[model samples]
Target: MPVLILGLVLFLGVHSLRIFADGWRSRQRARLGELRWKGLYALVSLVGFALICWGFGLARQHAVLLYVPPLALRHANALFTLIAFVLVAAAYVPRNHLKAAFGHPMLLGVMVWAFGHLLATGMLHDVLLFGAFLLWAVALFVASRRRDRREGTRYPAGTLRGSALTLVIGVVAWAVFARWLHLWLIGMSPMG
Candidate 1:
């Protein structure tokens, strides 16, 4: 639990810098130069991610139960995750409608993913991990939208073909993850 908390702090704290200290971040980026700054950022992110994975695995072994969620909620999580994958796909796919409307589909997808996992899992470690992500995503989303509005950013209008392709890719990716990757990586099958 301590290790998990530490990992979350390191990971989420670095991620929250833009949301909490935009000026400071900008100043640091300017001082460090873009290449150096990105290299440092990637290194920190990777270390934090490794710690998170290790801590999460340790926490899962203990299996501290909080509340037993109904099976229906678990099933509902599958739907939520499916939507999340689509939103994530929208972030990468060019001219997707979801990105055009949402402006930050990836952040929205993280929020949905965290929320769904929180609903389905009722362990202290699970709550800590997912809840932190949920809060961070919400904050980052709001911050990003506000920044966009301030800058008067405009997204390209999405074509039907692009949107359709994005959806198809998302669905196929979700199917593969839920069926195989989830089980292999997370040791649990979302579909089950």
Candidate 2:
């Protein structure tokens, strides 16, 4: 639990810099230069992710059940996760309507993904992990949208080709992950 908490703080705290301390983050980025800054950021994020994985595994040894979620909610989580994947794709897919509308679909995707997991799982470690991500994503999304509004940001208009490609990529990626990767990596299958 302590390890998990530490991991979450380090991971989420670094992520939250843009939301809570944009000026400081900008200053540091500028001071370090782009390549060095990105290298450091990736290193920290990787270490934090490794800690999270290790801590979660350790905590699972004594799983504390909060409440067993209904089977329906578990199924619902799959749908939520599918939508999340699409939203994530929107972030990278060029000229997609979703990206135009949301401006930061990746953050929205994380929020939905975390929320869905929260609804499906009810263990202490799961709650701690998913809840923290949900909160962080929500905060970051709000802050990002606010910044966009302040700067009068305008996303590109969507085209049918790009939109369709985005959907296809998202669905295929979701199917691959949900069908195989989830089971192989997490030792659980959302599909069933």
Give the residue spans of candidate 1 off by over 4 A.
none
C-alpha lDDT of candidate 2 relative to the true structure: 0.92
* Displacement of the residue 6 alpha carbon in candidate 1, Å: 1.4
lDDT by residue (tens digit), candidate 2, 1-192: 888888888889888998888899999999999999999988888888888988998889888999899999999999999999999999999999899889999999999999999999999999999999999999999999999999999999988888898899999999999999999988888777
Q: Tell me the lDDT of model 1 at 152.
A: 100
Candidates in order, TM-scores: namely: 0.97, 0.97
Model 1 TM: 0.97
**Over 4 Å off in model 2, which ranges?**
none
lDDT of 1 by residue, 1-192 (tens): 778888888889889999888899899999999999999888888888888888999999997999999999999999899999999999999998999999999999999999999999999999999999999999999999999999999999998988999899999999999999999998987876
The residue pairs found clashing in candidate 1 are none
Please give the distance, in angstroms, between residue 171's alpha carbon in candidate 2 and its true position after superposition.
0.6
Clashes of 1: 0
